[model samples]
Target: MSGKVFLAGAAGAVGAALTPLLVESGYEVYGTTRRLERMDAIRAAGARPVLVDIFDRERLANAIDCIAPMIVVHQLTDLPPGLDPTRMSDAVSRNARIRGEGTANLVSAALAAGCECVVAQSIAWAYAAGAKPYTESQPLDLGSEGARAVTVVGVAALERWVLGVNETGGVGTVLRYGNLYGPGTGRDTPQGASPLHVEAAAWAALLAVQHMKGGAFNVAEDEAEVTSEKAKREFGWLPDMRLPAQAAQ
Candidate 1:
């Protein structure tokens, strides 16, 4: 398998943390961001950043084709920085669009580029209200309120389009990450099961590139219903997969 990876949303919270890991893993990364300023930092991390938006189908397809990557990892989202809930209603609507419409454009671009594998980030907390910790096969709760309803619908769309890809050479890998925090993200630790640090999230994406396969795996700590047994058994993924915390010192 080729060691080249196309990391869409290369400047995101998870993307920022993942970039260093990609460089260290010796993968030629073609990262994308909507802004040019983000390219400088990405370049510093040994990535070739392409300034393009996921919503632009033509440009997006061209960018991917130019890279000719065997693997595509998507961590795109429209969450506001700091995640203030003052205007959460508006934020939810916009984020939902990213999960739904934005993801659709990515699928089209990946298919047009003849990319074989796609791995994307999905929320773990979007499962239905029945079980304490929802599994991958469980359905999402669509009967939610104003903002939550949009969130569930958007998540459902993103997952469907990613996993629905079928062809002679096409496979989708969805990594359902738990509540992300720590390093570059504002919330260092928040209340949630399956909590994952940004560093671990990055590691999981790299693992996907290393092992190209189809399946949804929960990427999170071994807290309650949030387990990564599938990921651990399949791709050797670990929730605490990080460099030493003292690396900061």
Candidate 2:
């Protein structure tokens, strides 16, 4: 409970919400951001700020090596604020790259640093078309076309890299989060098929860090799109969970 934790994408929505939780739970957190302007925000959230791009393998590896955290959390993404419609095409491609290449670099660095566990972010809406509620065992929509295809492919790669690390004696937990809303996210109310509050998503990541179990879990509200029962039973997560007002600040 009192070890080092390296959080990638510490300036992000979920990262911002999860940082204080990690700190309060007794972890020494080192958080990464690509922009110098975001460094203070990370520090304000109770973590030491580390400026390193996820795509910069050498620099990222060096940063993780210096910290030698017991746990590494992957919450990186490349989406624009509010998910602007006009820029979605470009955002999707960039985000796909983040999920693909960025994840590879992070897992590699985590392994090199001898991390005991890694918890990564994924999406719940990528399940292949079929049933009303998809389970973790369901296949991703790998055969889809256009933007969705790009996303699914990237999700698959990220999941493979994250889960495959378990074979090396490290625990890998992937949380397939639903469409996130709430603070830091553009939407104040729920949005998308399986809407999830940003704080609840952050809470799930904290649970994953605490659980140290390897496998995927759908983290979302009770909805037809996906089932979050696994996370609820395993991690005691609740979709309604939210950070206290002070902690949120």
Candidate 3:
């Protein structure tokens, strides 16, 4: 908590939820955003904002090196606001690129800066159709077609790079999060095969930074498709957590 934390995609839904927690927990938080206009929001959340594109390897690496954070949290995504149906196809491709090429760039940058121990965001719905409650060990839906295949491939790439970082003295922890729904995420209530509150998703990343042992953990509610028991046992992450409506008086 004393050291700095480099948060990628700090203006994102989960990032917006996470920045405040990191600041309150005593970490020097450095957050990234591509849009200059969003810097104020990052600052309001108590994080030093850096403007950089995740796709720009050189710039991102420079940003990371400049901050020299001890922990890196990957929460980048390219989804359209509210997941507009008209924009979903394009967003899917962009999001896939983020999970694949973008993750590679981030990992390279983190390693160069001697910053190990990454807690990355991934989805819980990518598991193949085999069991009722999919565990972390289940194979991804690699054989699927169309958009689902694109998603699975991207998720697989991201996980591989994150976990493989441990081979070179760095540790990678993957939180296979369920569909995030909460304030700032456009969903005030749960929706999807496995719903998760955005606050709980952010909390899971925070817990992983301090307690996780560098592997995949399903972060979801008590859903039928995915199980979060591992995260509960390992990181004490509860899917029911939500941001308080009012500050403590």
How well does each candidate superpose onto the true structure, as a TM-score? 0.92, 0.98, 0.96
Leading candidate by lDDT: 2
Candidate 3, residues 8-91: lDDT per residue as tens digits? 988999998888888878889999999999999999888999999999999999989988878999999998888778998998
Tell me the tens digit of each residue's lDDT in model 2 across 109-188: 99998999999999999999887789999999999998899999999999999999899999999999999998778899
Model 1 Cα lDDT, one tens digit per residue, 59-130:
888888888887888898777677666766787888788878888888878787788888899888877777
True-structure RMSD, every candidate: 2.1, 0.8, 1.6
Clashes of each: 0, 0, 0
Clashing pairs in 2: none
Q: After best superposition, candidate 2 residue 61: deviation in angstroms? A: 0.5
| Local accuracy by lDDT, each model | 0.80, 0.93, 0.89
Where model 1 places Cα greater than 4 Å from the true spot, the runs are: 166-168, 244-249
Rank the models by lDDT, top first. Answer: 2, 3, 1
